[model samples]
Target chain A: MVNVAGPADKIEPSFLEVSTNKYKGILSWLLTVDHKRIGILYLFSMMTFFSVAVVFGFLIRLELIAPGRTIMGPQMYNQLFTLHGIIMIFLFIIPGLPAVFGNFFLPIMIGAKDVIFPRINLFSWYLFITGGLIAVISTMLPGGSADTGWTFYVPYSVRTTTNVIPALAAAFILGFSSILTGLNFVTTVHRMRAPGMTWFKMPLFVWGLYATAWVQILATPIIGITLALVIVERFLGVGIFDPALGGDPVLYQHLFWIYSHPAVYIMIIPAMGIVSEIIPVFARRTIFGYRFIAFSSLAIALFGSLVWAHHMFTAGMSDTAQFVFSFLTYAVSIPSAIKIFNWVSTMYKGSIQLDPPFLYVLSFIFQFSIGGFTGLMLGALSVNIHLQDTSFVVAHFHYVMFGGTGFGIFAAMHYWFPKMFGRMYNKKVATWAWAITTIGYNALYFPMFIMGYLGMPRRYYDYLPEFQPYHVASTIGSWILILGLIIMFTNLIVGMRRGKKAPANPWGGATLEWTTQSPPILENFHTIPTIEKGPYDYSQFEIPAAKEAQ
Target chain B: MFRSASNFSDNVDAVFLYIAGLSLIVLIGITVTMVYFVIRYSRKRNPVPKNIEGNLTLEILWTAIPFLLFMSMFYFGWVGYKDMRAIPADAIDIRVTARMWQWSFEYPNGVKTDTLYVPVSKAVKVDLKSMDVSHAFYVPAFRIKKDVYANKNNNLWFRSDKVGRYDIACAEYCGLNHSKMYSAVQVMEQKDFDAWFAEVSKKAGVQPTLVLQLKK
Candidate 1:
C-alpha cells in the first residue's frame, strides 16, 4: 500500500492508498467497500463510456455535415445516433454526478465514515457496468443496434427489426442501479448525518442529492415497467403498445415520459447542487437565498414529475391535457429561474476568484439560461406545435443536458480533482480549454435553433440542401468541441501523474469535505466532528483584526 | 426566408417573438449582472468579501415575478391554442394517412394525392391517421403539427392566405426512409382548386390503382 500522511494522524494513509478488504493492488479496488474507491471506479467506467459515446456523437455529426450520404447510409446513421443516446443517457449522464461526486463527498459532507449501505453501493456499480456492457454489445450483435431513438417511441419500436430487446434490457438493468443508488443516498442522508447537523444545516449539495434520490426511486420504476412491457410485447405479440394489436401508442408515450422526463431532472439536479456548492466557495461569501435554492430542488422534483405530458402535446392528447401540461411546464421554469438568480446573486459584493471550476459554473449559467428560455418556448402550446420534433428540440436539450449538466460534470471534476487525486491540474490549460469549449458549444448548438425554426426536422439522415449550411457549421463546431475535450482531459491526466501535491483545502471557505485531508483518509475523518454552523458560514475565517488590517 | 403563409403562423410567430424578446432581455440582464459582479468585486480589488445571507425581499420578488411572467406566457399560449383548436363550422375535411415512408392526402371529393391540395383563404381541417407506425404531419410554414397515430384520429386545422406551395414533412421518426417522407401543400386559388378537384375526381374513379400506389 502506498502510504501518505492524512490530516489528523500523520501515519494514516488516504483512502486511495489503503483498502478495508484483505487484498493487494487491483483486487483491493475491485472488492473494496470504500465509498471513495467506488466513486473512483465509477469515474473510470463513466469516462470510458463517455469517450466511446463522444466518438459516436462526433461520427454522427460528421455524417450530417453534408445533405445526402456524407459517410454512412440512413440505417447506419440511425443506429449510431441510437447507440449514442442510449450510452450517453443510460450509462453516462443519468448516474453521473451523483455516482461520482455524490458518492465521494456525500458521506464526508455529512461527517459519516461510509454510506449506510456500502455493499449495495458497490452492487449498484456492478449493475451499472453490466448494463453498460450489454448496451454496447447489442450494437455489435446480429440485428444491429436499436434505431428507435432513446425514447423508444412505441409502434415504431415494436415494428423495427432491430435488436431492441437487448437495449431495453440494458436500460431496465440500469434503472435498477439508479434506484438502488437513490435508495442508498436517501437512507444515508436521513440516518447518517453528524450530531447537530439538522436538515437545513446540511450542504446544498446534500440537499440536491436528497431531492434527486427521491426522483430516482419514485420515477425510475415506471420506465422499468414501460421497457418491460415493450420487451413482452415484442416476444409474445401482446397488445400492450403496438397499435396493430389494438393498443394505444400514446399510452406508451405517457408511461415512457413519466419516468424519462424526471430522468432529465435526475441528470440536472446534482449539477445544480454542484453549482450551489462551488458558487459560495469561489465567491468567498455566504450563498444568497440558501433556503430558496434548497427548496427549489424539491420543487423541481415535485413539479417536474407532473409535466411529462408536455412531451405528448402533439401526440394526440386532449386540448385540456395539452394546456394543463403546458401550464405545469411553465410552473417548473420558476424554480429553475430561482436557482439561476440565486447563483448569480451569490456573486454580488463578494470577493470572487475566476478559478477553473468557477469558470465552468459561469458557462453553466449562461448556457442553461439559453436552455431554459428555449424550453419556455417549447412549453408554450403554440410554439411547441411548430418546434416539437425539429432540430430546435435537439438544440434545446443539448443546451440543458450537455451544456448544463455536462459542464457541471466538468466543473466538479476541476473543483474536486485536487481533493480526489491529491494533485493539482495546470490552471492555464484548464482555462483555455473552458474558453474553447464555450465557444465551440455555442457554435455547435445555436444554429440548430434557427434551422429548426425554419423547418428542419430532427433524426433526418439527409436534409434538403437549404439546411446544409447550418449542419456544416454544427459539424465543424463539434470538431472544436472535441479538441477542447482532448486538451482538457489530457491536461488533467498529465497533472494527475506528475503535479504539485494538493493541500487539504485548496479553495478556502466552509464545507465538511474541505476539512479533511486531500484524497481523505480511509474513514473520511480521524474522529467524527459535530457540526455547529451553516455550510457556507465564512465568518470563522474572518478575524476582526485581520479584516481591519486588510 | 421563413414562410408565414398560414393564419396560425402569425399567432405562433408572435408568441415566439414575445418569448424570445423577453428571454433575450432577461438573459442579457443576468449575464451583465454576473460579469459586472465578477469584475467589480474581484478578489484583488475587493479582498474582504461581504457575507450577506439571502434577502427575503429579493427571494420573494424573483419568485413572484417569474410566477407572474410565466402565467402570462401560459395565457398567450393558451389563447393561440384555443384559436387553433376551435375549428370553423365550414372547414373542409381532408383525410391524411401516414405510413412507413409516405403520406397520402385524400380530398373531400375522393381525389387522393401524395401532395396536399387545399384552396387559399379556407380553413382546411386534416384528419390524421397512421397506417403503420406513428408519424406527424408538420407544415413549417403553417406552424402546425399533429402526430398521426394508428387506429386513432387526430386532426389539425390551418387556413392559408397565400397561394403558393409549402413543404410538408413527417416530423416524427418512423423507421428506415423517414427523412424521405416529404410532401407539399399546394395552396391554390379557390377557382383553380375547384377545377383541379373536378378533373382529378373523374380520373380517380377509373384509376382505383392510384390508391395502391399511395399505400406502400
Candidate 2:
C-alpha cells in the first residue's frame, strides 16, 4: 500500500540533498522523518553517552588502584560507579547497534525506502535522549546521583536520600523508546521487503534484528513495571519489595532478573548478527548452514529468556527450582556454541582476507569464546555459589558485554564504514588500534578472574592489601584501552571529513546494501531489486559482469 | 591451587575443575582451529574458494557431541551441589544477621560474636537474615555462599575440614563500607569449641525463638 520506491527522479545525488524537502539548515535534520537521518541522530546521541560512561569507568578504576581511598570518599565513589553502570547498560550498550546500525541498514538491506513507522522512529530517539538527560540532571540534584548501584535493590534504594527515583524513572522511560523501536522493526520486516525477496532470502543481520526486536517488546515491560514498583515503594509507602513494610525483597530480584537477563540477549543478538555479516563478507564464501545460523539466533533469544533464574542460584531458592534453572542455563549455551562452530567453519577452506574488520572478528571469536565458556562456569550451581558477586563474575560480564558486544561493535563500524559514510579510513592505523584494544581489553578483565577466585568481591570502593596488585594492573590496562579507542575513533572522524571515496561494494559483499551507492540516495535503490538467491550466495557473484563493480 | 578447607570445598572444586578444565581444552581447540583455517585459506594462497554447501553429518556430529557433553557437566555440577544444600540432622546451628556494613553471628547457647566459631569436622548450618538490604554470606575457603534475604528463611551448610581461620565476607553489594564488612571464621578442634561453648553459656542471655525452634 505504501509507495516506498518514490518518484522517477532517480538521478538524485544523495539522501543529504533531497531537494524536495527544501527546508535548508538544522530544521531539515531536526524535523526530518527520514530513517537514515534518524539513524545518524541515534549515533550522535550514543557517542555522547558512551564517552561519558567510559570516563566514569576509568575514574572508578583509578580509585580502586590502591587499598584505600585514592581520589574520592566512599560516598562519591559509590555515585560514580552507579552512574557508570546506569549509563553504560541503559544509555549505551542496550540500545546500541539496534537503534543506530539496524535502523540505518535494515531498510536498505531489505529493499525498503524507510521503516514502516518513520515518525515513531524519530520519537523513540527523542525518548532516548530525554531519558539520558534525566540521568545527567539527577547527578546534579541536591543529594547527588543514584548510589544504589544500577540494580537499585530494595531498602538501600528506599533509604538512600540520593536521587533514586529520577534515575529509575530515566531507565523506565528508555524502555518505552526500546519497545517502540522493536515494534517499528518487526512491522517493517513483515510488510516492507521487496516483492521477490522471501523470508529465507533476507540477510542474516535482519534475522538477528528480528529476534532482538521480539525480546525488546516482550522483556522490556517487566523492567518498566519493576521500576514503577520501586518508585511506589519509596514514596507512597506501598511495600511491594521493601521488607520494612512487610514485603518480600527476593521477589523483586526474581522480577528484575526476569527482564534484565533477557535484556542481555537484547544487547547481544544484534552483535551476533554483526559477526555473521562480517564473517561471510571477509571469507568470500557462501555461509555454511544458513538456516541453522538463522534459527540459532531465534533459539538464543528463546532459551536466553528461560535462564534468568540461574543468576539467582545464590538467592536460596528450593533445590528443584535451582536445578531446573541451572539445567536450562546449560541448554541455552548450545545455540550460542552452535553459532561459534558455524562461524569458524565458514572460514574453513574459503578465501580469507584479514582486513581490520576481520581482524576484530578474529579477536572477537577468541575473547568471546572465553566469555561463553566462563558463562558455563557461572551456570554450574556449585561453582556459581562460590563465584557470585565476586570479581570473577565481574570479569565474566565484561568478557561478554564489553569483549563480545564491544568488539562486535568495532567490527561492524569498520565493516560498514565505507557504506555508512562515503569514505575509507586509514587501514594501517585501524589495524594497530585493534591490536592495542584487544590486548588492553583482555589484560584489564583477565586478572579480575584470578583475583575473584582468590576471594575478591566486586563493587567494593576499597579492598584489602592483597587485591592492590590486581587493581593496579587493571587500571594500567584501562589506560591502554582508552588510548586505542581514541585513536580508532579519531581515524574514523578524520576519514568521514576528508578521505578517499569509497566504492559501492568495497568488500565484495553480497547483501542488497552493497548493490546501492555508499551513503545511499534518499529513496535507497534506483529501483526496487528482485532477489533470486540467498544473501550469501557467492557462486552467483563469480560472474565477470558482477566483477565490474564501481 | 585453592585451599580445600571444607568438606564441600573439594566437591565444588571437582565440579569447577571438570568444567573449567574441559572449557580450557575446548577453547584452545576452537581457537587453534580458527587461526589455522584463517592462515591456510587467505586470499593470496587460495584465490578461488570451493563452493561446498555444507556437510549435514558434520553439523549433526558437533551438535550431538556438545549436547551430551553439557548434560554430563550438568550432572557433575548437580551431584556436587546436592550434598552442600541438604543440612544433616545433627548439623550445628548458627544464626547470622547482616546489616548495611556488618555481620552478627549467634550460637546455640545465645552466644553472640563478630567472628564465626565452629568445630572442625562438623556440619554447621548458618541461618541467614538481612537486617537491611540484601547481602550474601561468602566463605571462599569453603566454596560456599548464600544470599541473606530480609523476611525470608535462607540458609547454607558446610563442614570445615581444616582447623584454621578463614574469611567471611558480604559478597553482595550493600552500600558504603561494604568492603569493610569482613569477619573471620575460626575452625577450631572439638575440645576448644566445647570449652568456649561452656564459657559462653555461663555468660549468655535468653535464646531467641528462632534458635529454639531449630533445637526442637
Candidate 3:
C-alpha cells in the first residue's frame, strides 16, 4: 500500500500530476483511465458548454428586453433559444452532477480505487465530447442548425428547412454516451464498494448517483430510440410521427417526454444528492433521515417515471388520462417534499457553518421550494390549462432546473473545490458570488411568473407592448446573474494558481474521500478504507485546528 | 390585473388563490425555519452539534400533512375544471383552425373571420383544429387553453360575461412567425354580433378589405 501519513509536500503524485508521468504532455490526460482525470475532463468540458449556453441565454433575454428585434431578427432569435435549450439540457445540465462529481467522487466516497470499468468510463467521455462536437458542427452544416427548439416536435422537425438531421444525429450519439455512463456507474457502485461499506453506510451522494444511474440507463434508451426513429423518418422516408405521412405527431411527444420527464429526475436527483452531501458536512451534524432521503431518491425515480403525461395535459389528451397523470404528478411531489423537509431539519439545532457552500444550500432550499410549489400549481390540471405554454412555465422550469440544479452544481463545486484541486478559493469573494447569484436569480425569474400569470407566452420573438416592463426587469437580472458567474469563475480560476494548499478532510467530512489526500493520489487510497461509520455520522468528525483558524 | 371576461374566470381564480396562498405560506415557512435554524445553531453559538439522527414522528407528520393539502388542491382544481370541460347543448358553436401564424374562426352560419365575434352572455364552444402544427388557444381573461393539433378535433368552451375585446395568443410555439400569431376575441352585444354577421353575408361578393377594418 502507498504511504498515507506523509507530510503535505511529500504526498505522492496525484492523479493531476502529469509532469512526472511517463505518458508525457497531451497523451497523459487524453489517454488516461484515471477516474479523477476523467472527472476533470467532464468538469472542464461541461463548464465550456455551460459558459457558451449561458451567453446564448443572455442573448435571449437581451432580445426580449423590448418588443421588435433588439439585436438580431426573429430567425436568429429562434435559433439562439433552440441552441441554448439543446446545449443546456442535453450537453450541460442532465449529465451535470452525476457525470462530473459522480465520476470523480462516487468511487472515492464508496472507498473504491476506480470505477469497475475504467476504459469504458474513458470511452463515455470521448462519446460525450464527440456528441458535443457534432452539435457544434451541426450549426455549420448546409442549411444552418435545427430550430425546432429542444423538444424537436415532429412535423416542424420533419418539415423545417434548417438542418435538423444533424442535431437529431447528435442527440442520438449523446444518448449512447449517457447510457454508457449510467451503465458504468451502476456496475461500479454494485461491485466496487469497500468490503465493509454496506449499501446503507454509503454516502447520500452515492445513493443519489445510484438512483440516477438507473434512470439514465432505463429512460435514456427510450429517447435514444425515439431520436433514432425521428432520424429514420427524416432520411429513410418512413413516416412515424408526421400526420401527412400517415403518422401521429402527438405520439412523438409521448415518446419524447416518456424519457424526457424522467430525464428531469436524472438532472435534479444528483443535485439533491449534492445538497444532501453538503448540508450535513457544513451543518456539522449527522444527516437527518438518511434512510428517508435515500429511499426518497428512489421514490422520486419511481414516481418520476409515471408522471411523464403531466407534460401532456394540454397536448390533447382525454380528461381521464389527464386526471391520472395529474394525480401521479401530485404523488411525485410527496417524495420531493419529504426530501426538502429532511434537508431543513438536518440544519435544525445543529452547529451550522455559514460557509459559502451552506449559504448556497440555504438559497437552494428557498429557490427549489418556489420551483417545486409552482410545479404543484402546474400539476393541478385546471391551472395547467391556463399556465401550460406561458412564461409561468418557463419561470417554473428555470427556478427548478437553473435555480435548483444549477445552483446545486455551484454548491458542490465550492464545497469540494479544495478537495478536487488541492487549493482554496477566496471565501469572501465566494460568499459575495453566492449572495449576488441568489438575489439575481430570484429577480431574473420571479417576474416571469407575474407576466405568465397575466398571460405572456414563451418562445415569442416579438411580444406586445404590455409585457415590456417584465421583460426589462428580467433582462436586468440576467446582467446581474452573469456578473456573479464571472466573479465566481474568475475567483476559482485565479485561486487555483495562488491559493493555499488544502488538507485532506478540509470540511471535516466523514466520507472516505476525506480520508485520502487532497486532489487524491492515483488508485485513490493507500488501501481500501474499511468503513465502520456511515458517511454523515458527524459525531465521529473532528475538525483540524487550521480549518477553525481560517 | 386585467378584467375577468368569462363566466368561470372567478372560479379558476379562487382555486389559483387557494393553492397560491398555501404555497406562499409553505414557502415562507420553509425559508423561516431554515434561516432560524441556521442562526440559532450557528457553529459559534453551539460549537458542539446535537448529533440527532432524526425524529420519525415529525417526518410522518410533514409527509401526511402535505399529502392531504395537495389532495385538497387536486379536488378544488377538478371542481373548477368541471365547468370548463362541460359544453352546454344550447351553446353557440365556432370552429377555430390555427395555422403557422394566424387563427381563423368559422361560424355555423357559413361566415368565417380572422377575428372571433361571439355574443356576450352566451356559452360559446370552440372546436379547435390545427391545419399544420400544434398550437394552444390561450385567452388569459377567460382562463381557457386547449391544444389545436393537426387532424385532431379537440374543443374547449367559455361563456363571456363582458362585452370587450380580449387578447388570444397562440401559446404553443409554432414556426417562424409564431409571435405575430395574435388574434382578438370580440365579445359583443347579441344584436351587434347579428348585425355584423348579416352585413358580412350581404357583402359576401363585395370587396372584403373594408369590412375587416370594422374593428380597425
**What TM-score does each model's chain B reach against the true chain B?**
0.93, 0.92, 0.91
RMSD of each: 3.7, 3.0, 3.4
Tens-digit per-residue lDDT, B1-216, candidate 2: 246699888887788888899899999999999999999998789878876556788788878998898888888888878987778988888899999888999877667888999989988899999888889999988898998888888998999989999988889888888888999899999989877777776667443322344444
TM-score of chain A of 1: 0.97
Question: What DockQ does each listed candidate score?
Answer: 0.81, 0.70, 0.68
**Top candidate, metric DockQ:** 1
True contacts kept of each: 0.85, 0.71, 0.73
DockQ-based class of model 1: high
Model 1 Cα shift for residue B188 (angstroms): 0.6
The regions of model 3 sitting more than 4 angstroms off are A1-10, A18-22, A544-549, B205-216
Per-residue alpha-carbon lDDT of candidate 1 for residues A312-381, written as tens digits (9 for 90 to 100): 8888898889989999999999999999999999999899888899999999999999999999999899
Report the lDDT tens digits of candidate 3 across residue range B1-216: 466889878887788888999999999898898988988999889888887798899989989999999999888887777778899988888889999889999776557899998889988889998889888899999988988888778898999999999999998888899999999999999889878877886766433221222322
Q: For residue B37, what is the lDDT in candidate 1?
A: 96
Q: By lDDT, is 2 or 3 better? A: 3
Model no. 1, DockQ: 0.81
Clashes of 3: 0
